[model samples]
Target: MRSDPLIAVEHVSREVTDSTGTLTILHDIDVALPARQSTAIVGASGSGKSTLLAIIAGLDRPTRGTVRLDGVDLFALDEDARAAVRAQRLGFVFQSFQLLGHLSALENVMLPLELLGRGDARARATEMLGRVGLGARLHHHPRTLSGGEQQRVALARAFVVEPQVLLADEPTGSLDHATGETVMALMFEMNREAGTTLLLVTHDRGIAARCDRQLHIEAGRLKPAA
Candidate 1:
């Protein structure tokens, strides 16, 4: 792993306006994550774990401070530049699987590579699907697959690009315990092989325990691990 921090969140906070007044979703937070390390953001629902993840991924801006990815201040870049950085360096997995229902598994996995203008999108996506144990289901659509299988497809899509950082939000939240376990195992195995920085938001302590470090959030305030 790299000695320098791959991701740095400094005094970050977020607030939004509601019907009555400003609602703060996150308080001042500071965190630095090393390259190739797996870290879990653990908290109850509405504690701003997802919000923090979004800020780090450059999908959302922080209200108070800056987020640095690979030593570049994310918020300093223009929107298009930030998006380009995200496209090239970050991969995301969500709880809902986020697969296009009409596209086949192979197509879904190939989309990222296509977006990045890779000429060998199909072949690369096929190899990724096979690696995720979905070789036989490449032609199947998301609706035709089981929850576990759908998540596998999502994983293939995220990992196909060989991103520098992988951000997953409740990746197994929609599956049964056994199936979730299997999916998570594959995810970690792939992360280890790729040596990508893994940061995930999860409510399951069991899952959090499997990561290298766990950071807790309570009512939008970040608390260091004990």
Candidate 2:
């Protein structure tokens, strides 16, 4: 039998109000991200793909809806509780290679470990950097590394915590085709090794094709996969 979905997004919606009045970014979005599988969210820009990803990650609250991560109700939690859940269960990879400029690659990866107060933060960070083939560049800062290298550091950071789910948004958007391919390969390989579920948001059909399933969003609504 198949394992249960690790993420359940139920009737989610996101709206914003400004001078022009209310605008909806996501419309009653409902989907489940299955465990230990690669799933892609694909759509044109502003189609609410990223919004959906953020909500799943507990990075943003839906205007109306409930997101349950591992059967824990995320929306029911206070902000601090939600944040604690995020730190404990979710890992993120972003297009911009979100690393600290002031910190070395090793320090960057050690961040989550440090947050969890893992006593072996340095050792674990070092080992993860080696796994991503950045052992020699561990001391380098973001500005000193090539784009691909920086992205590798990001991958290291995301995997260091060994989270139950990985949330990635256009992780390859900032790199050239060749470099993106390398990083993506490493990402999938690590996910496999860790048995972590992958939920990716991207515009590249090729990348989506690599996923076990695809979620298509159009103008704030999700359509069944063709």
Local distance difference test values of all predictions, in order: 0.95, 0.93
For 123-179, candidate 1 gives per-residue lDDT tens digits of: 999999999999999999988999999999999999999999999999999999999
TM-score of each: 0.97, 0.98
Off by over 4 Å in 2: 1-3
Q: RMSD for all candidates, in order, please.
A: 1.1, 1.0
Question: In model 1, which regions exceed 4 Å deviation?
Answer: none
* lDDT per residue as tens, model 2, 70-123: 889998899999888888888999999989999999999999999999999999
In TM-score terms, candidate 1 sits at: 0.97
* Lowest-sum lDDT 10-residue window in model 1: 1-10
> What global local distance difference test value does model 2 have?
0.93
Error of 1 at 80 (Å): 1.5
